[model samples]
Target: MTHRITVTGRAGGTPGTGRRVRVLAPAAALALGSALLTACGGSSDSGGSTTVTVGSNGNIFDMPLKLADSAGYFRKQGLKVKFVTTTASTGTSALQSGSVQFLNNSPTGFTSALAKKVPEVAIAVSGLGNPLGLVVSKKFAAAHKLAAETPAAQVAQALAGSKGGVSSANTKAEAGLFLKANGVDPGKVKWVTLPSASADKAALSSGQIDWFITSEPIPLQVQNQGDGIVVVDPKKAPMWAAAQAGYGEVVVATKSYLSGHASAAKKFVAAVQEANNYLATHQGDPMVMDVARKVQQGVPDEVLKSSVALVEWPASGSMDAAGWTKTLAFVNSLGALPDGAKVTSENWTNKYLPAGGQS
Candidate 1:
């Protein structure tokens, strides 16, 4: 499915400012001391709570974990979750170096890190619902006679030779898959690297870029300002709907953490599942807003509300084996997975999830 390339904090939100956050990391590791304690899992400083240093990319994609912290789920599970805001690149290295015990990121990102010989495993499926997509400026869409109901194939053809904005190289690859799925020539679309969130907004506004592939709440932000209309809604697009049927987001951790502290891992997954359940039923609840406001500071409430409407939370905390397989293949096709890396469902486990997580 088409997904936004989350390259930086500004593109998503500031990392490490969440409700219960204790530390923040650069795109590189800033503190290796905590990493060692997390890997050891029995540090005296942890008191009675198991300290799990979790890394996040500082986007709304990490909302559930933040929600869990806000809702007291982590405390209920007797876990002290230490969140580290970092890019997937830095987070993966942190994971390998024992700086963090868990990471919340796209499955593709996890797999790419896995192929690089990082001993990590997918523990649970985060929210999905094809939240990643591309948007065309309303002006551009109107000029080209592109309507929301226009067939994707027709729209793809109209986008030929158009300048498109993306957050990262992986997202550019995702954009290619999206265009090809809609019967467009990926080679014909000129992709400009707009890694900064402000740059993307300005590019789209000044006609410097005709369209951009992004995830919420940028899509919602664009629509709220009446600057753009979503041309490819991953949730509504038939191609994306089919391709991402059983996939969305993943929570991963180093195999070493799971093996050394299995109980803590289970508690962490349970806490995530608890938060996921709360989100499934309370999208518009004030609790959601409270957490959103804290983690996604500076984002407009209207935009956050719009994003909640567009995103989907998983019904249960489970990860489907087949879906994981499909996700690996897709990432492999993108040439993101390293060669000689063995791919298997063994890389994920449902043992830690609540009942019904296994499929």
Candidate 2:
């Protein structure tokens, strides 16, 4: 049987942005099946082929996945892989419906999913820490004579007290956690959702919002405009620092999918490890641009370069379980998780990791 899929949305929408969506047509499976289904379900003994679908929101953080595909890592590992470009909601939906075999998303998404009984398991962590910052208009910052690297609490307080000074976050969870952690009451802040990084940038530049919570490159872009200041560096914030002490970005797969395709799954992890190595060494390579172009349209070369500096590509296949536990605790502190919600090291499994891939 064949299936057709359609992809929509701007190439560079943020965490919750619904843009950058693809719809699979009825014949999509047949049309891209051979190319997409390499080593999905077959046995190592018979060299049987397995078809697996992998999804991402197409952000720079997901560059390694794109690099792996372009480098033919999956093919070499004897698996056919289909790349699905989607937003948070859509990607989660695809994973739930079995339209995609695995998902690459933030740890928050996975935590939320597990809390909701979504039956998803995190296999490996890609990147850690927030990798984001709070950007404020230079006019506002200068008028207040705010210092760069101002504490996040001060930034949150400023946004909460400003008239018509709205703050935007990619998702409620992201925005909510940031606010609570920084000592700002979300209820007292005018919080809005801007799905696209570009859209958020526009709002910041136009003074539509007093503050915007976004990852690097975007914050760097605002700095380049000379109209924004980094009032809060999440990397330095204690709450975010504690969260990063837990888990960051992770590779998630359905329990059933991992159980059924063990070898292919291992190969997938191995390929990712190699891609991460490449990214670390060739930080400014054009391949980074190629990956960026596919997901974040209109990403200037400077922004791409800045993003690389902000994101620290992992070198091994192992996850920091202790760090992840700290992250879970931070989430609990923000009331993002239910009381007594516990995340043990057991929530992850290294059995499927390739030899030497274990952290």
Which one is best on lDDT?
Answer: 1
User: What C-alpha lDDT, on a 0 to 100 scale, does residue 102 get in candidate 2?
Assistant: 75
* Candidate 1 regions with alpha-carbon error over 4 angstroms: 1-39, 42-47, 241-245, 339-342
What is the per-residue lDDT of model 2 for residues 120-192, given as tens digits with 9 covering 90 to 100?
7777767656666667787778767676767667666776754323233333445556677778877776665
Model 1 Cα lDDT, one tens digit per residue, 13-53: 44545422433434224345545554464342535776678
Q: Give Cα distance to truth, residue 132, candidate 1, Å.
A: 1.8
Q: Candidate 2, which segments miss by more than 4 Å at Cα?
A: 1-50, 147-160, 163-199, 241-245
Candidate that scores best on TM-score: 1
Question: What's model 1's overall lDDT?
Answer: 0.74
